[model samples]
Target chain A: MSKTKNFAVVLSAVVLVCCGALILGQKVNAAGEGKITGTVKLDGTAPHMKGIDMGKDPFCSKAHATDPGKMETYVVGSGGGLENVVLYITEGLTGPAASQTATTEPVFDQKNCMYTPHVLALDVDQKFKVTTSDQTTHNIHPLPNPMTGNIPWNQSQPPGAAPVEKSWKAPEVIPVQCNIHPWMHGWFVVVKGPYATSDSNGAYTINNVPPGSYTVTAWHEAAGTQTQKVTVAAGGSGSANFTFKAK
Target chain B: MQRNNLRKWSSVFGAAAVVAFAMPSSAQQTKYDFETRMNIESHVGNITGHAKDAKPDYRRYCVGCHGELGDGNGENFPWVDPKPRNFQLGVFKCRSTPTGTLPTDQDLFDSIGRGFDRSNMPQWSTFTKQERTDLVAWVKHFSPRWVGEKPGTPITIPPEPEVTPERIKAGREVFARVQCWKCHGVLGQGDGPSAATLTDDLGRPIAPFNFAEGARPKCGDTDKDIYRIFMTGLDGTPMPSFADNIKPDEAWDLVFYLRTLMSQHSKEKAMAKQLGLKPVDPNAPAGQQ
Candidate 1:
């Protein structure tokens, strides 16, 4: 009778320890996983964007139809919010988070003689693809600042051509343009860690940020860069807002 | 024993299948096709008149000489003299632009429209304005050097001074002072004393500009082109810039003299053609054959 009682106690202890370990493992996995969310706003009235002259290419002119394509240098949103601002953790990232590889390849598409995304952000060493959907041929040229250590490249993609896949070895803010179509321009803001571009609503969220104090930088093509410091708690959230004044 | 044999066969078949599947995927792995493929699907339902009827078809005219990839190693490369311009290197011999910079769109258009004299490149002036524009745009895709590079601003040419006998005489002196005869022989036949030893930056044997053949100068035959070449020398070759060494007026004189050399060569060639005789190679010495 005593032996049976001891066996029951031992089994219960074993079950309790196993259950505790499983729960602890789940908690450990969730630790240091936080998100940074914010809005990028414009402090002043947005500048009037100049109309693009697509007369050089008939295909481009026809694509826009009646409406003239305007310069996308500044894309302002409702409530004075600025769009396409790249917010990324510029400092204090280490270990796995600093070297994390992006699983999904970021795509930059040229459609209707314009870059679909005026601005795009991706991590360093991540595969980036440039595709053209227009009937007219487009030459995709990315001119990275020589200081960024990323070499500049140019390639032409005809209609029905496969997407050009490439990856940058270092972080850079690359200005992409088509020599054939001067008005067609865009940017590839490559970052080292988690990053996000503000949407039409001017809201952005950078998730999977390891819990730490970091200097988050907000970059706009025209307005330049703004940075802020924020601390993220374990499995918690942080915020860093930015505002740019008209030049 | 039968089971073992069956197992071995099954493994071999599995390996063979894997290899076959892998081969096609590898072949299709290029990010972009070197040759442009027609988009049949996009053009299928062309109820709209907006669809373009004329497209720049490089394959029909250029691929035979310029190569499918524009590397200048086309199928007819062996038969062509002086070879076609290799677009991959982004080095264009004919341009108003300074060295290390791309040519202006107008420069490319002129080359394509006028054609290179004495070479196999035919004048493509028959192409429509739109076709020429499209071709120019298409050719830029051959090199990555065009990316982010602004075309070199053309050097302004002062109006030509009168081309008199005295000007030509001074030009001859200027030419000799610049040692033009070192590569271009005393008669401008491209067989000077140093011609045998001349090499480009890449150590490739380079032929000096043969002025006695009436061939089109690489930078164009215009007075402005000659002046430009004098100011901004050809890059990656033995040509050195005379911008600092020579005055503008002296450069004009040199141009006048070079023109005379070209005209003299053309006159000789015309005479030979009229006589139905093989034109003599001025570079070759007598009694050499």
Candidate 2:
């Protein structure tokens, strides 16, 4: 395995193998597949939510620093900015059922009144295209439980229309609240695999996965769940990380 | 000179842990080194009135607030708006099994070894069931990372039943006569020897987790998220909850020596070699996302 460890294992298998990353002798339903890339890194540290009166808001005194509501760095070290966090891939991950030139799901957005992505992970089935640019109205809750409870859908985005898509069968973690902005929250992890989405710098990637044995999870609507365990060694490539603790 | 008297008693214990994390919390109120379990029959686990039997100083009197090494931090954990409790992300708000499931090791040993009287964490039966199975194997040793540069420690080693071969060489001599090699080093590998001066809560350093970098931490091989981490102790960090004093087959042989101290590292082998693909094993499950 030399030639620089086979190009350091082919540049960590093409910049972190995605598309359901699998590979041991190749057979999770192998057809020349295996992938998962990484990068959901927001640098680190930012918690800020504890009885947030933040002296009665301005986006809670610019994303809050203290009023018993601490958690700085809306800028320093860089924390929370990318609104719709949906790094998807459902069970054995390869891709499909996201038609629209290969965009099966995950594009949910809302820009400002909070929820630009307090974290949203996806995988099972797909379909979730929400949109709102803001003029108020808000409320598009989607709190899935009973593993996707008949896809517990909700809507209200109002403002400028044209962005509503929906779909999800099971997996869990969807609590997209905004009863007209009761602190406008968000979270939607679902996961099965073939994931990515971590910007404003947290970084994420998941592609073409076919190799197998996964347990790769990393979630954070507020900050929780950060699993790991990957093998994908047929054509070979693997690396996983998730740190969240800075609320 | 035990290394200059343990480096002057770890620089006076790192200036008393940075003056107990710079005081406040109403003047530094926290301490539960281990021991809490109450009488043993004040609960029954969600049948309404009989479920509180796991307490063991829940990893120093209940993990900071109620997180997985009981989940709650990230500075102060967005101040707990129904957040906190990563019981290795099994998820629970007070379950019967419907809000996304995952709560029964008796509904997490009766809501953290029986306490919840309006919550922020209380009632840790006086500690035992082996300090709530050593604070449920130190709240599944807060997710083991580190691979080669060495990491994955505090300890999550459960799973050793069957015995023989002189009790698996006396359980590797009860794992170095239970110093677990001073914070799991030698081979359980989180770098032990007190892991080159630990650190975390922002001091940095912090290293441990190295079962050959294969980390898959939900930190629960099950048994009700390892008995709700030996009956609740992850409210914040140092991880302590052995639910009265270990048992349930010694919390499953300390979760198989903390899953052999997770040889550490595997965000799906670093996102399958960072997008280039093919290292995949993630325990052999197939692909589909």
Measured by TM-score, the strongest candidate is 1
Which consecutive 10 residues in model 2 chain B have the weakest lDDT in total? B144-153
RMSD of each candidate relative to the true structure: 23.6, 28.4
Residue pairs in collision within model 1: none
- For model 2, what fraction of the real interface contacts is kept? 0.00
Taking the tens digit of each residue's C-alpha lDDT, what string does model 2 give over A50-160? Answer: 443423223334543433343222322354333234455433433331211223666767755555555656555666687767543343555454222323333344345
Off by over 4 Å in 2: A1-247, B1-46, B49-101, B105-107, B114-123, B126-162, B170-183, B187-289
Residue B46 of model 2, lDDT score: 30
What are the TM values for chain B, all candidates?
A: 0.67, 0.24
TM-score of chain A of each: 0.86, 0.32
The list of candidate 1 runs beyond 4 A from truth reads A1-31, B1-289
Chain B TM-score, model 2, reads: 0.24
Winner by lDDT:
1
Query: What is the C-alpha lDDT profile of model 1 across A60-172, one tens digit per residue?
Result: 88998887899999999999889999999989986446656566787899988889899989888899888878866565667664324454444545455578788876788
TM-score of each: 0.45, 0.23
lDDT of each: 0.69, 0.43
